[model samples]
Each structure stands twice: as structure tokens, then as C-alpha cells.
Target: MTETLDTTVAFRATMGRLASGVSVITTRTGSTPIGMTASAVSALSLDPLQLIVCVGNHLFTRTAIAEHGRFAVNILGEDGEDLARTFAAPVPDRFAGVAVDDSHGVPVLQDAIATVVCQVSQALPGGDHTIFVGDARHFTHKSASRPLVYFAGEFGVMS
Candidate 1:
């Protein structure tokens, strides 16, 4: 048990050194929007425009995404630390006072550096997380904004 715990700690510490862009994955169940801060998003293919997002199995957003069959990845800007914390926390209303647009059938963060709307193509079990493979349908971005980054247990901007 001690060895397993030590390995888990070491693994987390090691991965924390790898800088990654932060994003908020958003989806809606009927009229209610659900979102969560995630750093495990990546492009999987370009031929058919596919990306992958990993959501923890325990998160409500994971089930929402699976049920909704669509989601948006809001790549946050350098000024998005507060927004990141809001979505990452267990707040009752994460969207309180936050600007959002759901015209595309999924919630999109209006202030995000980039927003990608995707239709879920596949879902694969990935250990403690669900790997959602999305087929990009629409996207928009702000050319002038720098992305929010996560590294070593902190939020930062690329220099």
C-alpha cells in the first residue's frame, strides 16, 4: 500500500513539471450547462478534425458530456486563472456572472482565447478518466490573446 501511494505521488509530481494549456470543457443537459476545468485536452487528428479530452470518471461533467454527445473546449486566456478556479471548484453555480453563448447547442465561453465546438465521436475508458474523442464542427479564436498555462501546481502565462 505504501509503495502504491508513493508511486502515485511521484507520478503526479513528475507530470506537474510538464507545462500544459488550460481549458474549460463545457456541455449542456437540456437548459443547464455543465463545465469543468481541464488540462488534459489535445489534438488527436487533422484529417477529420478530431481532439481528445479526458475527464475524471467521478465528475458530473463526464456523465453530462457522455449523455449530451456534444461539448466545447474553451482554451483559456492568460487572464483566465480566476475562471479556471471557478470551474475547478465545487461551487454551486460556476456560471454565475460568466458570459456564455450556447447557440451551437453547447456552452461556449465568450472570453476564451479559443473555442472549439465538437460532437462526441467516441468514448474510451482511460483508467480513472474517460477519454472523449470529439470531431470538431466549429471553432473560433482570438489572435491577440496569450493562453493560460498550468505547470507545477500553478497557473501561468507563456513568456
Candidate 2:
């Protein structure tokens, strides 16, 4: 038999053990743009070019992404901590003064280490979070900058 976890406590402990790359998930809502700092993103496959992102059900960006049907994942560079926090907060104008442009109807941050515009291929309920599977249509990368990393609830820079 499989051992069941205490859930809440076990979840924090288990997640704390996993180190994740930091990303800024962006979706446009009407004329406004919304985004959030996320670490729970992973590549799913290369055949169809897919990736998975886990978003909390209550986040506004989650709803925006669903309605918009697409999103851009901006993989931040080492100097992007402030930009990440700006988008992650519950502010009215998250994209104000930020240099971003539309990429196939998705918002892509400028100077990101990498960016991927994806169409929502599937969405499913995953306990406290929703699992979003996306099919990447366009992608770009820069070899110059090091990526900003998130691990154990903190932001880190690769040296």
C-alpha cells in the first residue's frame, strides 16, 4: 500500500526539496497585461513542443490565460528579480514601464534569457493548482545571460 501524506505539511516539505527555474508567465487581458512569477513550469515533450505550468486556481492570471487561450513564458536572466516581483504582486499596472511586446498575441518580456509563446492545448484540475499544458508555437533564446534560479523559496543567481 502507498503511504498517504499529511497533505499540507507534506506538500511544503516535498516542494521545498525541489529546486526550480524561475519564469514570468504573462497573459494579456483585453488591453491590459497580467503576469506572475512562477517556478512550477517544466518541459513536457519535444515532439509537439509542449510545456506544463501549474498555476494556483485563484490567481487572476490563471483566468486571464484561460480566456486569452495563450501565454508567453519569459525565462528571466540573473538581473530580473525586480521585474519578477513587479509582475507577481497584486498591482493594477504590472506592465507599466516594462519593455514587452506582443508575440503571436502573447506578451513577451524583452531581454529575457529565453521566451516561449504557447497555445493552451489542455487544462486540468490538479488539486490546489491547475495544470496547463501548452503547445509552443514560437521560441527564442539568448546565450549571453545566465538564468535567474529559484530554489527553496528564494531567488538565486548563477555565478
Candidate 3:
């Protein structure tokens, strides 16, 4: 038998027990670029090389992703708090002067531990967000740095 429950308490308690890697989601439209710090990225497959990103339904970045049909996940390392803060804010033209480009023409931040470029395969409605499934087309990695992590509502450095 299934029981109904409120998400307010359940979500917080459940999230409290989970630790996630931090990433900066970046996208571009022509020359305009936007970025956001998120910890909602996850791997979905290996054979077909798939990844998933949960974007808030109401965020401008989500609209950008839908319109552009592509995005880059910049896996941040332990020293990425500054990058995280800048992206998480409503700052104007956050990618200005920063070493980045459309690796797949999708605005990937430089110096990230890894960059994954993908084409959105599906977008399904999921509570307060939309789950975007991406087919990984290209990827790059730098194995020299420890990853940045997020847990219990705070940022952490991987040890």
C-alpha cells in the first residue's frame, strides 16, 4: 500500500542525507551567455552516455536551455566557491572576460575539472523543476583537482 505525504518535511530530511558534486551550468544564445551553479546533475547511463540536469521551471536559464537545445556542465573543483557565487546571483553577463567558449558552441567555463557538452534528449515535468535528459556528445576532463561538493545546504571541498 502507498501512503501520501507532504514534501516539505520529507524533502528536507531526504536532502539532508545526500551529498552531491557541484557544477556550473552554462549556455549561450549567439553572443549572450548565462550561467548558474547547481548540484542537481547526475549520470543516467553509460552505454549511450547520458546525463540529467534538473532545472527550475521558472528560471531564465531553463528557458535558455530549452531554446538553445544544448548546454555545458562545468564540473567545479574545490576552489570554485567564487565561480559558484557569481553564477548563483542575478549578475549581468557573468561570463564577461572569463576564458570560455562554445566548445560545442554551448559556452563552457574554463578551468573546470570537467566539461560535458550535451544535446537535450527529453524534458519531463518534475514537481518544481524539469528533468532534462541529455545525450552526451562531447566531454573533457582534468583529473588534477578535487571536486567541489555540496551537502546539507552548504558547499564543501572534497578531501
Candidate 4:
């Protein structure tokens, strides 16, 4: 008899082939800052200018963003690949070597291609992750630079 293939592996392989921009989702509560490398993000609205990020339920940054009611999406540039990998790993103090600036209250990556500050408009449960819908508050206009892209389990610079 033939063995059944794992759907989970299939899903991952298929998605891995899809090229996507890299971004860091960040927030702070009190004096503590939180960040994570995320590729599961996209715009959800235009009238109010909003976006959604899928964060694991147990992620510390997810809880912090909920508590703080705010977050900033730092779009990584070609040079930000290292930063993206750092944030993706479970290393302590992901922001250890990262430089940031406080815009309003959100911590924005100084070297990011762009920074979009947003307020949490809704938090919806989606299986193992929470989908946070954020309404854009402030942002930096896109600058001249290539973005970091992830594809097939690897990182690359956009042409």
C-alpha cells in the first residue's frame, strides 16, 4: 500500500516557493520592546489605511502589541536581511544590536525601507495564530532601495 503524504509538508513546500517581502512587526509595553520577523502580512483596507499581521498566539510580541494597542511594521530593505534573520530566530534580545527610533510610542527600525505605525483595530483568532488588524497612524514614505525577499526557505534581495 502507498503511504499518505503529509499535508503539512506539502503546504509548507508550496508556500515556500511564493516570494514575499520581509517585515518586522514591533511594539512596546512600558519600557520593553518586542519584535518578530514576519512574512504573513498584507494590506486589508485602503479607506482607513490598514494592514493585518498573523502572529503566533504564544509569541511575546503578540501579547505586547495587544497590551500596547499599537505596532509598527518595518519593511526590510536589501541590507536588512541580517536583521530579518535575527528577529526570526528565538535568540534572546532580538533587538540587542538593532538601532531604533521612537516615533510617537512605537519603535521604528532606523534602517528599514519604511515604517508604518498602526493602532490595533481588531484582534481575531485564527487557529494557531492571531490576526491583528491595524489602522495606520503614521508612516514614512518609501525610499530608494531594494527590499528583502524570502522564497523557498531562503532570503534574497529584490532586483
What TM-scores do the predictions have? Answer: 0.97, 0.91, 0.89, 0.93
What's model 3's overall lDDT? 0.86
Candidate that would win on lDDT? 1
Give each model's whole-structure lDDT.
0.96, 0.88, 0.86, 0.90
Per-residue lDDT tens digits of candidate 3, residues 106-134?
Answer: 88888689999999999999888989899
TM-score of 2: 0.91
Clashing pairs in 4: none
- Would you give me the overall lDDT of model 1? 0.96
Highest-TM-score candidate: 1
Candidate 1: how large is its RMSD?
1.4
- Candidate 1 local lDDT, 1-159, one digit each (tens): 345888999999999999999999999988999999999999999999999999999999999999999999999999999999999999999999999998999989998999999999999999889999999999999989999999999999998
> What would the TM-score be for candidate 1 when compared with the true structure?
0.97
C-alpha displacement of 5 in model 3, angstroms? 14
How many angstroms is residue 105 displaced in model 2 relative to the true structure, after the best TM-score fit?
0.4
**lDDT, ranked from best to worst:** 1, 4, 2, 3
Off by over 4 Å in 4: 1-5
Clash totals, every prediction: 0, 0, 1, 0
